[model samples]
Target: MLQKTIHKSVACSGIGLHSGKKVRLVLRPAGENTGILFALQNGSGRRFLTPRPESVIATGLATTLGQGGDSLATVEHLMAAVRGLGIDNILVDVEGGEIPIMDGSAASFVYLLRMAGERTLSARRKVYRVTKPVEFKREGKLIRAEPCDGFHVDYTIEFPHPLIGRQSLAMQVTPQSFTAMLAKARTFGFLREVEYLRKNGLALGGSLDNAVVLDDYGVVNTEGLRFSDEFVRHKILDFVGDMAVLDAPLWGSFTVFASGHALNNAFLRHLWVNADEYLEEVSLGLEPVAGLEAEPGMVTASAAVLA
Candidate 1:
């Protein structure tokens, strides 16, 4: 399996979830081994940032990656879109401190990536494969990961609400499955919570248009739910994004229960700190699977899975 990057540049503008200001995002093709590079525009100039477990400085309403005094908020959805589509190298240019909410799902980012197209590179892909089982638990939340041939997730989310009770989903994450199943699931929050966030000067751009807002009894969105299990699917989408903080893609079967952004980042930190006991970096060979020719839109699970 070879590394991949975008074929051309693509740009979009939208309102930031926390900043409530117009933000511009540009995606440009990068050379092999570039990974995901962020060129953050600021008053001084552009500063490059590479996502890492420790770089996550905050996880209130969204994952915030920070270095020095610079930080970018609401990055998970876009990260999920990049990793889910099997893009190995790319340059993300951000003009605002936060990524656009974009309907609070990865769907828009997926569309942008597809429009940018995909190009295979000469370098073979590399991944950090789990070599031993590891479990991280905090309070009642938990994340357990075990060795697997590909990236897989069994996630369960429990909420004390009539509309959300408990939802669970398990799947082998691939471009086909991620695009068809997880990409459209929108982030959700409660009515009271939204009010509190706004009062405290947060989630300023959040609304029914970007997120699935639930009142005391049911959904407030006129469109209703995108899927019966959209909540759980969204959690899985977030899990993919959180794991992308690693320098290389991770390959493992993860079982997550009631884990949020804070717990997810904690678990990732644990795994990274104890990497000698849990991870093995392996290079996926250059050749495509026998009898399978690499082509655009090909669903080849034989290639190592993306986060």
Candidate 2:
């Protein structure tokens, strides 16, 4: 497969999930091998940032990347959109300290990226293929990964709330699957938690419009859930975004159970420490798979097995 970038520039503005302030984001086409870059605009100039596991400064409420006094917050959704769409090179311009939280899901980003369209680059795509199995566990939560030729995930989430007990989703991630099945899943939070965060001056912009808020009995949002198992689908979306910090596309079969941002980053750190033993950098030769060229808009079965 060849590397890809946007064909044109696109921009949008929305409320920040944490800052509660209006923020603008612009997506621009980048040159070959540019990878994903973030240009944080301030009064004086722009400070560039590259996402990395070690650069993760905070993962409490969201994944945050920082260097020196500069930090970006709530970046996971946009990152997920970039990776999920199979884009390897793009420039993300931000006018604030964070990307705008659009409906608390990747659906809006997906729409924007499609509007910008895709352009194939000259360079072959770089992929980090798992060569061995690795498991990271904390308390009862765990993330297990094994060798695979493509990215796939089997995710399970459990909560004690009456509306959400246990939910699971398994699928091989592809552009079609991501757009059709995962992008619309919205982030969710408990009503009591939202109240506490608001009192503490956090998540000031969060409301029913962006997130699926739930009380003791059921979903407080009038629209209810986007998917029957939206919670697990969102977890899978988050996993895709967190994995993008590796700076190369990762091809693995991952089984995750009740893992959050902190644990996900920890697992990535551990994997990086033993990268040579567990991972290998491979290049796709850009050859089309046999007997699969004529079918447009069809994701290969190997790349989109859902359960």
Candidate 3:
């Protein structure tokens, strides 16, 4: 399958979650083989980092990319949007340390990408399809990727809070599935944990306007949830976003248990470290590089993960 990119450039502005600084994000089309690259568009000096699975550094509150002395925080939502739309090449220009937290969901990003429209490129698409099972285990949380007929996931999350005790969701990751089922889920935080999160230099810019805040037993947001199981759906959104680090589409059935940003990154790292486990399918699971939806063609991969 061929690659895809935005036909035009689009921009959005918001505040950083930890830095509390206003930031602007511009998305522009990129050439084939250029992959997904992020440029820091500020006086901090322009440094670019490809959002690779191995490049993920911190996973505390969000998926953060750190290289040398620079970093990008809270990138999962933006990435999930990019990945779900099946776009392989795009340039993200962020003026601050973090991507804008627009509506705490990937829907806004989808709207922006749609506004720019999408065009097929000249390069064949690539996909990382699991051929063997490779697993990563941490504390009791474990994530495993196994060979499957197609890309799918079975994720289960458990929290001490009564509202979100245990939630599980399993689905095949598809463009239609993502937009109809996963796009509207909003990121949620606990109201009681807000102070501690703030104390730790996290969620400083979080507000009712951007995220869903849950109190002791119920939601505090004036607007209720966009989905009945918005929490689990949000987790799925995050998984899709984090998988974008591969800089391509992924195909496999993964079983995730109590995994968050850190574990998600680790899981991708495991697959990246074992090159033989995945094969690139440009035709079956990817869009053709020539603006055609073609069957995924399989190719063996090597050691690298992302930019």
Model 2: residues >4 Å from true position, as ranges? 288-307
Candidate with the greatest lDDT versus the true structure: 1
**How many angstroms is residue 121 displaced in model 2 relative to the true structure, after the best TM-score fit?**
0.8
Q: Which stretches of candidate 3 lie above 4 Å from their native place?
A: 277-307
TM-score of 3: 0.88
Model 3, residue 5: C-alpha shift (Å): 0.8
For candidate 1, write residues 198-222 as lDDT tens digits: 9999899998899999999999999
> lDDT of each model, Cα atoms only?
0.90, 0.87, 0.79
Each prediction's TM-score versus the true structure: 0.94, 0.94, 0.88
lDDT (0-100) at residue 180 of candidate 3? 84
Residue-by-residue lDDT tens digits, candidate 3, 120-179: 887666666677777789999988888654458888888777778899999876666778
Residue 202's C-alpha lDDT in candidate 1? 87
Model 2, residue pairs in steric clash: none
Candidate 1: 10-residue stretch with minimal lDDT: 286-295
C-alpha RMSD between model 1 and the true structure: 3.1
Error of 2 at 154 (Å): 0.4
lDDT of 3 at 64: 91
Kindly indicate the candidate among 1 and 2 with the higher lDDT: 1
Cα lDDT tens digits for candidate 2, 1-307: 6788999999999999999999999999999878889999999799999888899899977899997678999999999999989899999999989989999999999999999999988877777878899999999999999987778899999999887899989998878788998999888899999999999999998989999999999999998898989999999988898898867788889999999999999998888888888888777764453433323543332222112
